[model samples]
Target: MKYSARLRLLAVQTGLIASLGLGFATLAYSETILTVALAANPQMQTAAKLIGNFEKKYPDIKVRFQTLPENQLRPAVLKDVATKSGQYDVVMIGAYEVPLWAQKGWIVDLSQYAKADTAWNEGDLLRPIRNLVSYKGNLFATPFYGSSSFMFYRKDLFAKAGLTMPETPTWNQVAQFAAKLDDKKAGVSGICLRGVPGWGQNLASLTTVINTFGGRWFDQKWQPALSEPESKAAINFYVNLIRQHGQPDAAKDGWQECLQLFSQGHAAMWYDDTVFAGPVLDQAGPGVKDNVGFAMAPVKATKASGWLWAWGLSIPTTSKNRDAAWKLISWLTSQEYIKLAGEKAGWGQVPPGSRTSTYQIPEYKKAVASFGDLTLQSINSADPLRPTIEPVPYSGVQYVDIPEFEQIGDFTSQQISGAISGQVTVDEAINASQKKMTDIMQDAGYIK
Candidate 1:
């Protein structure tokens, strides 16, 4: 009986030890998953590549990316943060949203992270982009890529047509060039432009056109100006140009679509973010890379015509994994990562306009020598404080900075898109946009 009891005790102890070992193993191997929400753009391609390196470096953290279109990303992220849903740990947002969202207590103040890290090199960031993403001297986000608008054209097509493009073309001159270059039967459109009905899609480029035409979103008194003569004329010119010379189904095209069209030789000219110069110049792509030319964004009434913008990463206040999120943001935006991307993805693909050091890279300078100077000039000259020819009550080149501007810009873009599709007259669209802006401003107490 004593021997049998000893065997029973030994068996029980072994079983307990085995169970405890299994539990400890599970705890040790389990990883923390970080969910990131980002826009589906070419920059995200570089980000995806870096993520492999990130995971290799930090094996305990797993990342899952939620990529959405530009039009869809803003609403999805806004809903997630506004409701404190905690669905996204990291979000890619624009400079326009950083200050506004920070003010609403939706995003964490990233100054802490910047200050805590000795190697972050916060001063390396371009001053204009840094200021745009900061609120009252506190950093709210880290810019991944920054850009200003410029014009891209086919040098071969210009040569064949016996036409010469100017260094700074006017909108009127662009229209004349478009009329001469348009060849519908040859499977080419004269120009490509964003026509998608979203504030950040079509209105991003359109707002700059409005500014260059001497139109402001709101007057000094915060009164809506869409129905004013200058605003109406700008809208008319844009809609007519696209309808006459732009690609088929132009009303549905946004940045991605326009990029594809221009890259594939379906369009003779494109006016968009300068960051696209890389993709357009990519040797691996089916683009007119060898014959592409650059010029300043077309202007009418103002010399400072380009619009400034930055796509950045931020951690929401509701994030459960703030530490890991900051780690990812810092790594992706670091000078080291820029060098990695240049070496791996080619020097032309490095994200520009964010770091002054990027321009100093010898390889990058040689790679982008064709248009680097022009890109820097455009970015440096864009003054958001005085974006429009007339004085305005806002501080953005392609957008109004207030929170209410999102809703107003969205509603107004839908109306303007209707004009592009011929479903509504330009006058009708402008009137509707004006009324909506007035209502929003009045309700927000920006106007009585």
Candidate 2:
């Protein structure tokens, strides 16, 4: 009955197996794989978590993230982009790089993509943040989140000490408060600040201080000003404040270390990025969540003293997967993504300062009640174009917008960090940096 029947059945089974294998291969081949470089911050971490939703929505596109700490992320992406290596289809960059990269044609104009995608709601972005990420009105990148510097103080500690913290304390007052609140015996420092050396690390905080003290990186004439009286005063005050009453090993502390210290109740106050308010008041465990106070960035001579910044996503000109990259970017930066983040992670953890609509969400406003209004206020007040009280040729608060600033800020931060570590005096550090700046400015033709 069935030798021929058995042979026919075996052939049918073999064909079925081959058909299934071919179908799986076709699926794999059709799916687009995008390599994205991301900064290893909390929001970006949440983005990595939520990326699965994007993959689910577009089953044909797969995203692979290469996340690194802020210090490492900058150089790795810069090297790849500068060499046109095409290793990364997308990279996380800051507002500082946006204009320069756009001008150089290193990154492609994203305006067309944003224009085509009407659902993305490009106009919903905050005006200040939108301007910062654009060059000559052409968008080269989209901000994942925007931030400005502000102060965080422990209200319980302030009350216990019978001290009334002002809504906008001056730097001098902050120093006095630090002196009073500093309790070394109880394992608490008065304040926590970034001391780790990097352009975006310690220098970011220090630059704002310099600005408030009525100092500019360069005068209108483009002369070096690091060793000028106002600049020196700012540097000395910062270095002295940290050495005297800042967290121990202050020289070794960056934003992450400082956040850890403040969140662990080891510091009475912290002056840092407004983004930290979320982690401080709600997300970063239970340190001072119930007793934190929000205030404007401590001021000196200027009416305000905060720096504006944003971490953004951009496509390099060399990227082959531009469409796929833009798909990922639009998805991450859209209002829908913000809502998705608020739902999946806490509303407190949603990326902030980018969209006007983010603040309007009822849940988000409630979740960040302590800092929401003030965060928006601070971001709006920050003027990167007119960063310093005195006129200067540059247009950055935490950084300069030139390509050489990477080298300049890094070098200057190292010298100032030496002052913080006691390896060099304030005068020595400033003098060395001023000399270096003079040479750089002259060589770059900013000065004769």
Candidate 3:
């Protein structure tokens, strides 16, 4: 061979070798990206902030979050998972969705994964929450945080008004208190309650009111009962209470908006999830932390009225990264992550209501000294099985457990929101909702 030809061949070989080396380098550094869909809430936001630790610990994996509002998150996740689209590796869901999705086999079972991970301490999880996200004895999701509904009032406002808040207040007493404390001229509403139209929004609080007022969604024979006298009375009271004394644009407000109004001192009282305690105390305006007082959900016919809920992370069966998803979930829901959140996000802001050990953490205990035990008590006391005073063929507190309930609740919320906004009367809303629910029940074969 010619000397020049030999030199050219050697040059080509070197270039090819360099190209091969570059490809190997790229492979070594490439990360497995995990797309996660999360509900937009303060607790979830805090988790997002602390997620940097997870990526740092697992350098080979990267997480991308798609945070969406409560109403939008549900449908987006449902559409993706139901279609078996591999759009997300992990999704944030609630106790309401867990069992239904698990039974349908749309979400991967985490029981074996959790069992194999002894360090994950599945037993440490709160029993109500654990059972809530399980189906047929299999753990399908692990709770990031759990909550039960309750009331939070401003101690200063109550004192100034010459009123006292009972540890377990009655709805009638709350109404009387609201009448006295309403100071719209001072830029404060008497109370803040969700009025936005969504199953998880206004209806959540409204359903509890209905339950406490001796109403059920259905009678023992599976007949629509929203038009019943008790249910209608509950609806009237709820709509009138908010219309008379709730925050401005009450019809537009949901849990997040109410949280803001109360935390910023724009509202004197709030009735919603216990999870609000974390953000209200640690991240709210000055003076909120010192003045906020907790109370059980106000009751009338029942002894307890709180509703059980838990926001958890689930691995979809459609995910190609199931193992990686479990690893991230196990870590995110682990005791270590809870401690990390306390250290990094301030102890008052750590995730609550998921684990027994979370309460045992000294910093967490001190941070939420006023409301921690009450949160646990509320969660434990909620009885989904017997939520209503009358016998019902469904199981749930703030919601009905069937898949059809979502559509039914959404339609009812729209009608109820119209009443709240004065576009319709309470009776009109109730009648329309009753008719709608009846049609839905008959269509779903729940009633014939």
Candidate 1 local lDDT, 1-448, one digit each (tens): 9999999999999999999999999999998898999898887777886788888988988999999988889999999999999999899999899999999999999998999986879999999889888999999999998899999999999999999999999999999999999999998999999888888888988999999999888999999988778887889999999999988888899988888888888888999999999877883244487888999999999886999999999999999899989988898898988998999888877989899999999999999998999998998989998998788878999999999989988898898789888999989998888888888889889886
Give the worst 10-residue stretch by lDDT in candidate 2: 279-288
Runs of candidate 3 with Cα error greater than 4 angstroms are 2-23
Judging by lDDT against the true structure, name the best candidate: 3
Q: Which ten residues in a row have the lowest lDDT in candidate 3?
A: 280-289
lDDT of 3 by residue, 7-42 (tens): 999999999999999999999999889999999988
Number of clashing residue pairs, candidate 1: 0
By lDDT: ranked, best first: 3, 2, 1
Between prediction 1 and prediction 2, which has the larger lDDT? Answer: 2
lDDT of 2 by residue, 219-244 (tens): 88888788778988999999999999
